[model samples]
Target: MKKIRFYHTLKAKIVIIIAMVIIFALQLMGANFITQTERQLVNNFQENQKLQMNFLENSFAPFLEMHENPKDTSEDIDPEEEINALISDFSGTGITSLIVVDSSFVVIGNSDTTQQVEVGQLLNDEDVRTTILQGSASSKQIINSQLNARRWRMVEPVYSSEDSQAVIGAIVMESNIESIYEQITDITLIFLRASLIAILLSSILANMVSKAITDPIKEMQTKAKAIAEGDYSGEVTIYGNDEIGLLAQNINELSEEVETGQRRIEAERQRLDSVLSNMSEGVIATNRRGELDVANNMASQMLNLSRDELAGQNILSLLEIEEDYSLRDLVDRKEDITLNIEAEEEDALLRASFSVIQADSGYISGIVCVLRDVTEEEKVEEERKEFVSNVSHELRTPLTSMRSYIEALIDGAWKDPELAPRFLDVAQSETDRMIRMIQDLLHLSRIDAGKSELQKELIDLTALFTQVLTRFDMLLDSEEYRFKNYKIERNIINEAIFVDVDSDKIVQVLDNVMNNAIKYSPEGGKITCTMTLENNQVLITVKDEGIGIPAEDLAHIFDRFYRVDRARSRAMGGTGLGLAISREVIEQHDGEIWAESINRDGTTFYIALPYIPYEEEEWGWD
Candidate 1:
């Protein structure tokens, strides 16, 4: 930063301003005094000239009386010679010249004898003509170029003694007063010299006063700079025990407090940095302007952002909070809020604690948010609920049926051997259903707990499919034939397909798929079975011509206890756990199974398993 110069300082500028104002006032007073004195002197000189013109007017009065009456008493004298005698009589009254004009405006008299012969010339000067008409006096001053002096010309009318309003002629007087103006100019010079001396003295005094005031301030400024550089030892050495010295004392005290506070703040900042960086929960704070000002390391990681990227971002826009709430709303909250947030790559459960950053006076300044990731906790809670519901539902039906059958046996159905045996069989079947459900639940729980493993083997898929289909074909021989008139059409390649998998589990998967197909197929409907080798994998498709599963239910077919037609599944002894277990088995074998269906048509279940390729020599007839 550039240091301010002395001339630019407040004290120096104030001194200059006060000096200029004082000088301007002094100069204005002197100029006005000179101007008024000169004007008064000129006015007195003009008054004196008017008095001299009045004397000339009186001298010419007798001749003017004679011209107005046109009497024979005035004709005895020569007209030219009488005017010459009249003008020459007042030559000593400070009059430069005297001229007389008749009412016809012809000059008739002159104070000089040489101009008397030429006095009959008409005087057409406007001022002389006005004097003749109005019977009054008028004067004008001009600089006489030939004489190089200021002079005044005065014209006075000479009224007739007989008719006072009638003017027969007028007197014109010229006077010189240039010497008075010269005297006033000399007086003005003296005033200007005095004003200049006064201004010089004022300037010196203003500088002394300004320096006395600014010296203390300048010393305090230097001390302040030292304090800014973290040197708080120096104090301002002021001259007197005045306000400036008191101000210097206060500045010294402020410097000490600031140094102490700075050290304390530094230590607190280091501690805060350590705590924020090591904290597990994400912490983000926004300024009152709603832009993010502080975000810890954990916050950056949780938001999938860099520290620089998160800073200065609008908090409301970053979170995309609930439609009804915003960052301001969050700040207004008095309790913590848990919200669901969709992260960049996955969904997350966030428990957010909000606090309004405030001042001691209870003024809200900004907002602070502490966020905790509860994603795994929420997932565990949801899975626990689903597991309990599924397990209870799966066990309830078998328990209810077994209870009904046992009650029937106790209610005298045992008296008839036929009824008794029938009820006993039903009870036995329900017990077997319960056992199978419990076993399946245990296996699924193990798989979910990550404790289950597949028994890997190299199995021939073609022979396996043949054996599974043959068992279904044997099912038609039973009395109540579920596969009656249901033809099993096979589309199998001649080459044998071998896959690496757990043979028993893979067999169970295929058995579930085939059983679903046969169970849902219409009587006399064809069940198509195809096995093809493509891209080093065996694709086995079991398609049935029956009522297909609905579109919405297809995606969730492998979820435990999820049945498309629950009542129908229960009637057909379908546990709804078969497909879920099959999916788990296939995934363990590194294979995939999926089912496709459309409305009112049929469903096709496809299973893909990696196959081992054989050399040409081993196949012999490839």
Candidate 2:
């Protein structure tokens, strides 16, 4: 997928490496061949020069001997002329110059006629003088001054044929040796051309061979790119039964495995999403960097943010715990923490349980926090503690009163007949109050535990309410409550509205409401009982002219032990469980009950019971 330079490619590398090896080999071979050829050429030329010098030495030996001995001759022989004539005869045979010098280093014969003045002069050339004095041969290569060519110069001592050791004269010869070097140069050129041709051919062949190896690899690279792009359907084409082909097969297999793994991962992700979405509690997951990686719907809702908004936010800062705790602190924490989160509508208490996501290598990868809304749970716990304390206070008040009255009777108050009777009566009254409170508590307990069962029967709801009002009317006009005058006004429907209900529980509920009305009503206040049938249900309302409940306490009126005026309700013998019990009974009957009040004006309680229309035949009363 990435762009690669030509020089960095495998094909280019192979070609370059092969080219380098060929060049090195050719250079080494060329150097050795040229060196050996030059050495051979020089040796051959030197040997040929030696033979020429020997011939010249032998020819001049007799002449030199005759001159030295002053021999009686038939004619006067000019040995120098003879030597010159002999040198002139051999001039065109690759020889540059030749000269014969006497034993005292005096030049006798010169091959170049232009320099004939030095024929009898002393040959001051150091090579010639050294050869003549030492009676040895010496040779050196030099460039010819006339022809500007390379040549070998040789000096040999002329020896006597009779006395082989005696030095007679020295012969100097210079021969052109340029043709040998020219031959070597031609060979070197041929070798260079051959090397060039070889390199060109090798490069082409190397490119071809490298292509054979690299083509499949390039295909595999393409396949890898496809895989990276989530295209696992494509497979590499195998070129041969070599390692490349094997790798291609493995790649195909890996593609299949990767596809399968991707599907499984997707399924797991969907499953996780489902679980998180359906959960009642919130869930939050953070990556190793302490950044928000996942936040479920509940989590987002609980945090008053969207999932997208929560993503990539630092966990500590997201939860507003950065100042108090760090990421490492949370990772090492073993206990659940409480977070007071400000939700969309209100503040909520959440219990956050922490867990670490760990790998097999004991590496902590991330952290998971499960958030459960515990607002209601905490409220219930507080209410429970309050309930126990209230129960103790209520029972203790009655018990303390009864104990004091009994102790007074025991402390010789029995001797005072009047005090003893009054004390005993007070003790009995306190005992009765305690018993009533306990009974109310037990009844409420049963209702809360779902152990209370309703005994149902079809009855006249309007007639039942009229009977309850009749009892309150009689109680209000009785001798005991004559001072607190109350009037009952009935607005009953005169028709029987039949409904199914537990008659006894219904009576108990109506009595509690009527008693509270009587206790709170002003003198001669009207307690109006109204019953009507609406929307296939019977609605009964008990309205009284009394000090109404406060607005804030209206919502919690049905909660156990809750009273708008706690002291007033206790003085009126109210157990505070009456309305709570009434609501439970109404709900169990699939009906409804609620209250409406205006401060200092009046209060009204309504009870609606489900109504079923029936003919007399249905109840077999026809």
Question: TM-scores, in order shown?
Answer: 0.46, 0.44
Model 2 residue 11 distance off true place after TM-score fit, in angstroms: 64
The model with the greatest TM-score is 1
RMSD of each: 29.7, 38.2
Clashing pairs in 2: 107-119
Global lDDT of model 2? 0.84
Taken over the whole model, the C-alpha lDDT of each candidate is 0.81, 0.84
Alpha-carbon error at 324 in model 1, in Å?
16
Residue 87 local lDDT, model 2: 85
What C-alpha lDDT, on a 0 to 100 scale, does residue 550 get in candidate 2? 80
Report the alpha-carbon TM-score of model 1 versus the true structure.
0.46
Q: In lDDT terms, how accurate is model 1?
A: 0.81
- Candidate 2's residue-wise lDDT over 1-622, tens digit each? 5799999999999999999999999999999999999999889988988887778777788888876665633357877678788888989888878887888888778878776347668766888777877877887888877678888888888787778888878888888889999999999999999999999999999999999988998998888888878998867887778898899999999999988998997888788787788787899888899888778999998888899999999988877778888888898999888777876666788888888989999999889999988988876786699878878877776688878888887889989978998988878777777787788888877887789999999888878887777777778778988887778888889888788899999998888878777778888798898888899988889888998878888789898778899778776777777888889888999999898897657889898888989898998995
